[model samples]
Target: MLRRSAYKNLQQRASQLQLKRSASQSVASIYFPSEPTAPVLKTESIPGPKSVELNEELGKVFDNRAAYFVSDYKQSIGNYLSDADGNKLLDVYAQISSIALGYNNPELLKTAKSDEMASAIINRPALACFPSAEYGQVLKDGILAAAPKGMNKVWTALSGSCANETAYKAAFMYQAQKKRGSLDFTHEELSSVMENKAPGASDSAILSFEKGFHGRLFGSLSTTRSKAIHKLDIPAFPWPAAPFPKLKYPLDNHKHENHAEEDRCLGELEKIIKNHPTDIAALIVEPVQSEGGDNHATPYFFQGVRDICTKYEILMIVDEVQTGVGASGKFWAHEHWNLTTPPDMVTFSKKFQAAGFYFKNPDLQPAQPYRQFNTWCGDPSKALIARTIYQEIEKYDLVNKTQEVGDILYKSLDTLLSKYPTKMKNLRGENFGTFIAWDFTSVLERQEFLDTCRQYGVNIGGCGDSSVRLRPTLAFGEEHAKLFLGIVEEIFLKLYK
Candidate 1:
């Protein structure tokens, strides 16, 4: 057995590697301290008395049926979520994969407490019309600093749906400009558009893949095919949906079959672009389809899609909302694709705190202002937090660290997967940092498993169909990985025997 010194050495190394500030430095740590070295379970069931009471009170005024438990953000710490009942759980879901650098990070707290952040929060600006004094520099230092290669300009939005919806607008406007070719809009065109008619409204569509998700807004909901609940009641536009590949795993074990499957999907994608009922304005896809079961595609598959979109003059939009900001090993997951030409637009949110779309074509900007206008275009407060988050990520090289931890997690998970093959299968995200997931036999089984994880003091989450996804914070290091694996091993044993 490894000696106690082994663990000591690990912690010692962690201290040495942590930010190197003087002991007397007045700056407070941005994130909360790592605590509950192991998860602390107090009750037989989650949502124990305190949580149930809070939810019941909340239900009197709002929807609380979906409430998992009442969270106590103040008590939560790195990779652990604290509930009102005082249960601190190893949190892998990480607020539906949004939290980066973990809760209450020291650097983030400092940035939050800074004069700059306070000003931005109290006196927010309409970024597009009257950007603040620090707006230009703030963007250059933060979001743009980590932008996917070849993207320079960014248009901030409110959420993932807004980002995607705006990107679709940009694509439609850009495509119209390319077709219009210096011609002024006719009087009939302008008036007809107000009535939502053909000529001025442009009858163009954004092409999305099957089993994909963009958002819940009208334009974006049409592109979202992951679930019916998010779209069932909403009146949707008739946008074209292309088939995405369904590859067999382990990928290496079924190489040729997977390649053939990708090719088949590519064929369908090309056909959809060429023969869609409406002109295809853009083709949007997730680098790793997060809401659609952590589905992944190969570089070859993406390149093929890019080629098809180019050939058909359809703009390519990579929806990196959940796959951006270093969660997927690289800063942007599409960075792993190595396309010969960059995507037309990249929509982002989740980990960045700030939400927006990056573009190279200035034509994507509407010919007139207020066409893509909103009250608060995007929050500068979130942008300030994003800047701090980006800087801290660089300071600690947290992306690379997450990637290293992911490798360890993957290997251990493979052993667990083997032990309970019937309970789980198609394990993925091997080299893609800590953005990992696996499939259960059924949706019920998967839901039960998540509940079981909660009983064991691990707040895990499920995704598209029957997948148990791992979307831990970037600060989920080797120690967290080991603890997670220990619980998982125990759960699998209990599940099987």
Candidate 2:
């Protein structure tokens, strides 16, 4: 009934669709052949029986108040997280965005079971003083291989907080050393340091942006301006907090307004730097402000900040704790900024497993040994895991795949969220791979949405006051995205229809 050309066109279209579907399935299948095609909800409710009982038991020995459900890590596969009650939910939170590849990935499992990993775990050396011979090769192959442009050296640490705190220490030491150039410590300086006073204990501060979440350690907590709950009753330094731009969503529609907002924030930042009582040693910022609310700014805004920091001679530290390891459609989220020069120090931890700050400036290291000393400088076991993660990511071209999946997911979300503007708004992370978010109308509305997501076998997470953030693993393919979107739409229909 059709002309030859029309029939050919139809055939071509069908073939393309089949190819897309095949590609989507193949990526996930390559990593997790046994991965469930859809969420398997065995219990009538999440935490049905076993999970609730386990949580109650766990509460006696540990703080289980925040336990969504007792996760069965052994049963989890690919993007699906299994709860104690045998409920397999497609997990987009991905252990607060820490899981880079997937749950129980075979490659990671093999790495874990290897003799090298076992030796590192059992014979864990105090890395700074007595690092194993293989340590250098391990770092070279893994962390160093993935370092951002212009960074060649790394100072490893224990956690995200430790990474930022150490970077802060480096900044302060570097500034002080520059000030005390070619001069040995004065007697006054020596005596004053013991008393935690000026000259020895530098008065310089690390500046952070408002609504930015750095970490919870003492020094890092002082820079963290996210939530009061994390800082209550803790003694914090009097560090200046500058405003971060509050850009409006649908970025294309509000280009002028967003640009103006960024300029205003940058101006305020310079003013704060100029007026702060103490010298500002460093300014640490998150590329996306994950915990604070997944806040984002344009490349122009970041370039402005970089220029200001350079002019002021203050160190610029980019905290990529949550936004690193290919989640942002780039290895490092700041790569999107295309800055004239890389940040002075870039801290990473969440997805990489190994926590540290990378730098090109050898001067950042203290002139004297034991000045930056720690017992276990960094764990080799974690480094081994990191090596495996990097190898797998590169082997599969997972970053590109993540970008492809995120493009499809973002487009689908844009279309779906457009119909429910009253219930949700401020959709963000457009081109950012699986790093998407949307804000609900109210805190209660957000809570209900998150609760409903779990009810429908989707383990999601929230940030800031009322924002749902998607932090799926790198293995999260188009199939996972489609499943997640369908569940989200089902939740919307049930709640808003």
Candidate 3:
């Protein structure tokens, strides 16, 4: 019935569809040959009897109040997470965005079982005092290999909080050394330091933006301005907080307004820096404020901040704890900014399985030894895991793959969200790989949505007040995205229809 040309066009279209399907299957199978084709729901609810019982038992010895369900790590694979209830859910949260690779990745399993890993875990040298000879090669192959542009050195730490805290220490020390300038410590400085006074302790502060979430440690907590629940009764420093831009969504529609908002925020930041009582040694910021909210600003905004920091001689620290390791379409989220120079220090953790700050300035390191000393400088075991993660990411070209999947996912979400503008709004992370999010109309609605998602076998997570974020693993393919989108549509229909 069709003309020859039309028939040929149909055939070509069929061939292209087949190729796409085959590519999706190939990538998924390469990472997880045994991965489930779709999520398997076995329980009536997420914490069905078995999970509830296990959580109750876990609570006896640990704080299980936050446990969504008792995870069965052994049965989890690829983009799926298994629970004690024998339900397999698609895990977009990815252990709070820490799991770089999918669950029980064979390569990671092999690394875990290797003799070198075993030796590093059991013989665990105090890295600072006596690092193993292999540590250098391990770092070179893994962490250093993935260092952001203009960064060649690293100071490994224990966690995200520790990384930021250590970077703060470096900033303060660097600033103090510059002030001291070839002069040895005075007797007054030495005596005042013991009393925790200004001459020795220094009155420098680290400035952070409002709604920023750095960490919970003493120094880092002082800079955290996210939630009161996290800070509570704890003592905090008097560091000033600067306002971050609150840009409107559908960025294209509000380009002029967004640009104006950013300029206002930049102006406010400069004013804060100028008026702060103590010298602001550093300014720590997240590329995308994850915990505070999945807030974002344009490259122009970040460039402005960079210029201001340079002009003020204050160190700029980019906290990439949740936005690093290929989730942001780039290895480092700040790469999107394309500033004239890189941040003075970039801190990373979560997905990398290791925590540290990368710096190019050697002066960031203390002039005297033992000044930055710790018992275990960093764990070689985590470094080994980080190496495997980096190797696997490179071997699979996962960053580009994630970017491809994110493009498809973002487009799909844009179309889906158009019909439910009242129920959901402020869709973000358009080209930011899989680090996307959308906000619900109310906190209760968001909670219901998250709860309903689990009821349908999807383990999702929320941030800020009422935002759902997608933090899927690098192995999350087009197939996973398709399945997730379908599940989300079903949930939306059931809730809003």
Candidate 4:
């Protein structure tokens, strides 16, 4: 019999061989054959002179305060982002997690070039009133096919914030209808609505958790409790926010304590739902709380939330905008919870290239036709692209493969972070695919680390006050993960040690 060390060495070697074998067949390779194998640093600094000049020119007409660099999209490919300076950086941020397949994916370009796409773009239909002949098939074959379990209907919107705001409208309308109970609107109700008063304009609210970020729009901003800057100087709705669990690091080491913390937060949530001044028609929550530090709670906490929503008869919405489309090791992050009842609506946008909410209940559709109406209700071009993305994901099984790659990345990161425990801490998102994040000692440290990362030819992003997050595209594979790990470890050793 071989010794334990020999067996472990053999296992490691086998894993390396497997990774190399899969690299040739990776989705990135299949789609982006011309993708760069490693980052190309041509300039001493990121946002080099050419990028700075272009951005300065762009700033004359547009707000480019937050611009990292002027990107050359034509030159960008696969998991790499190219700047005006002709420097190609390994982009784990992936345009803030929106690129599903990759930059300039051939299949997406094919869809863009098709006659149907050109027609959709040139003669964009006002979808609600003049939906194209292929609209139903488009929904059926694409977005609806990828819907979360127990969801079959979709109300498409223009963006993530729009998707959330529309979902709120649906919830408010559904609840109002239930209260109306077959009665027609009274003259007083009709007249009061013009004044934006009660009995017409709803006093109902949407409940979200602390450290949660829904969006920056008027209605969604009320539910967005992530940052003061986003909400400052904006008139926000008087909505309620409940506590989200503050789980400890290395979750396995603090299981009992974390459970207690989650329960406490759940209790507070129940109290808020029962006692808020306004009716909470719906409660929206992010699975990983992306913008708010990537906070995570166990399935127990989510299941508890599901139970609470059921008891209160309030709609439960899962905001999968950042965690959706196979990034979380599942098509939807809520799929990890295995809730007894599915979320009332699941909102998606970022990666899918289309924004919408998925629901099963017919009641969610407003009683009046134009109640949910708008010009250009949804973009057909985006829908066509979403269809291609769905087909590709299904054909390639990217979700499961993402999980395998994430497992390897997370374990390697865990080992790396252990060497600098104080410098980096609270690593989270285990078993949640590539949807991973961790915190630094302070906000400055995190920012410096991000700046250092970009300087090293790897573009990453930060979330919340003091956390670094990895929002790699679904096309990311073991090869990409290894490169990323190596870069990060090198940076950590140089800076922290």
Error of 3 at 189 (Å): 1.7
- Candidate 4 structure quality by residue, lDDT tens digits, 1-497: 11234224323543554434234557887887677666777777888999999999999999999999999999999888999999888899998899998899999999999999999999999999899999899989999999999989999999999999999999999999999999999898899999999899999999999999999899999999998999999998999999999999899999999999999999999999878988889999999999998999999999999999999999999999999999999999999999998899999999999999999999999878999979987799999999999998998899998898899889999999999987889999899999899999999999989988887778999999899999888898887888778778767876877
lDDT-wise, the better of 2 and 3 is 3
lDDT of 1: 0.85
Error of 1 at 309 (Å): 1.1
- List the global CA lDDT of all models: 0.85, 0.89, 0.89, 0.89
| Candidate 1, number of clashes | 11
How many residue pairs clash in each candidate at the backbone level? 11, 0, 0, 0
Regions of model 3 farther than 4 Å from truth: 1-26
Listed per candidate, the RMSD to the true structure in angstroms reads: 4.9, 6.3, 6.3, 5.8
Q: Residue 413 deviation, candidate 4, in Å?
A: 0.3
Weakest ten-residue segment in model 1 by summed lDDT: 21-30
State how far residue 119 of model 1 sits from its true place (Å).
Answer: 1.3
Residue lDDT tens for model 3, 1-497: 11234224323433444424344453657767777665667665677899999999989999879889999999998888999978888899999999989999888899999999999999989898899999999999999999999999999999999999999999999999999999998999999999999789989999999999999999999988888999999998999899999989899999999999999999999999999888999999999999988999899999999999999999999999999999988989999999999999999999999999999999999999888768887789999999999998998888988988899899999999989999999999988999999999999999999998887778999999889999999988877787778768867887899
- Write candidate 1's Cα lDDT for 138-194 as tens digits: 999998897889989999999999999989988888888888889988898999999
Worst 10 residues of 2 by lDDT: 1-10
Assess every candidate by TM-score. Answer: 0.93, 0.95, 0.95, 0.95
Model 4 ranges with Cα > 4 A deviation: 1-25
